[model samples]
Target: MDNAPLVIDVAGINKRFGDKHVVKDLALQVREGEIFGFLGPNGSGKTTSIRMLCGLLTPDSGRGTCLGLDVLTESAAIKRQVGYMTQRFSLWDDLTIAENLDFVARMFGMKDRSTVVDKALDDLGLSGRRKQLAGTLSGGWKQRLSLAACLLHHPKLLLLDEPTAGVDPKARRDFWEEIHHLSAAGITVLVSTHYMDEAERCHRLAYIAYGTLMASGTAVEVVTGQHLHTWEITGTGLQGMGEALRALPGVDLVASFGATLHVSGKDRDALEATLKSRLRDTPLKMTAVPPSLEDAFIYLMQGSQDQFQG
Candidate 1:
């Protein structure tokens, strides 16, 4: 990954909207053909940082290049070679799948419009529904169409903002498969998503909170960096146990996952001792488990001060 050329290299980028500082001295580097996932809580400047990286918004103070084009000076050129898929379905709901692709192709002034449209439809499995109106399509199909439209320009970099927000599980899986396919084709993808499963699928991840970057690295690296210890307990009557566990010494977080609870803390030995003493008389099954990405993220968020909170 280090040997690959950087598709996005920016530093000290900051942005604000009146009194709210949305992004703060952010620095990021994305390699060519990398699937970089961005994770954060709401109003954390994930969207704003994406725009700055792609030249959609100018930074208050920063310097860098995106695809070797000056982000501040050559935004027009950068925009031409980038495909941005917004969070919302921005395609014309009234237009057919094929018509929508054609319209996007026309906007980019692409040549051989028919061939491009046909290939896009086929690539996204929309050919069978070429004549179907986008509004009539399900969330999954609409997502596929949005991706197809973004690719019409043959962009070198793709900036996707919550591309699978409301998509079903099966559709989300299918969409991730397509993203991997694109990365294999040498297209760099920077996507923001709230789903932990989706975040894990990325080659690397960055977690931002309150306009500040808190953690970044491969999924394993991020988890290990936090040095968190966890214990998984599952048994009957575990519903109200989470609140009781949180107040115990050495317990930092208690998160429920279905019928199981993951109790985690930063101090390993202390946490183990505390859990052992507390559950000595109970019949519940307890096992020491590795902290999950979700656990690490929640820990990071809890430690961060929300800059927007009054």
Candidate 2:
């Protein structure tokens, strides 16, 4: 990672709308040719932070650089070098696939509009559906077209906001494959997502909540950083077990995954003692397990004070 260039470097960025502080002194760095995932609950300032980083929105107070340009004063230059794919399908629905690409190229004032459009179509597998209407396309096709349009200018950095939110599992997998392909070609990607599986796919992750960053590291690092002890139990009478476990002295979290119940806490000895004493003669099968990404996020959320609720 040290050998790669820095695509985005920003610090001390803050934004507020009315009296609500959306992003709070956020700092981040994205290396070239890396897929960095940004994650948080809804209204946690993920979108606001992404916009500020990519130069789409200015922060209330901060200074930084994006793609080597000043994020504040050089936003126009930074905008020209970055390809932003918004959460919504922001393309023209009335236009055909090829026409949409042509329009995007024209908007960017590209001299080789046809050549760029053709290349984008082939790269995103839209060549065969060149005449298909954007509005009539499926969610997956629309997503591909949006990506294609973003690449029309051949930007070095990509800011994708929940690019696969409504896409099917198969389509999401295909989209990620294309993203990896782009990354291999030296394009830096910053994507925000809610799916844990998608978050795990990134090289590194930053989790935020209530306008503040909670954790930042690899998946394993984040999970281990929580210093949580988890035990999974599979049994027949586990309907109300989650609530009961939450009320116990040592348990900090209790989540049910189908037939298994995951009980976790920060205190190893107390948790173990409580489990051993409570389930000594029960028919449940309990075994110690490593804390998962979801477990760590939930733990973090539980401790976080919601900045908007008050």
Q: What lDDT tens digits, residue by residue, belong to model 1 across residues 263-310?
A: 999988888898888888877778989999999998888778533453
- Give the range where candidate 1 is weakest over 10 consecutive residues by summed lDDT: 301-310
- Angstrom error of the Cα, residue 107, model 2: value is 2.0
TM-score of every prediction relative to native: 0.95, 0.96
lDDT of each residue in 1-310, candidate 2, tens digit only? 7578888888888999999989998888889999999999888999999888778899898888899999888988988888899999989889898999898888778998888888888887778889988999999989988988888888999999999998999999999999999999999999999999999899888999988888988899999999999999998888877877788998988888899999999998999899888888888889999989999888888777543454
TM-score of 2: 0.96
Which candidate should be chosen as best, given lDDT against the real structure?
1
lDDT against the true structure, each candidate: 0.91, 0.89
Reference-based lDDT, residue 71, model 1: 84
Q: In model 1, what lDDT does residue 260 have?
A: 95
Error of 2 at 9 (Å): 1.0
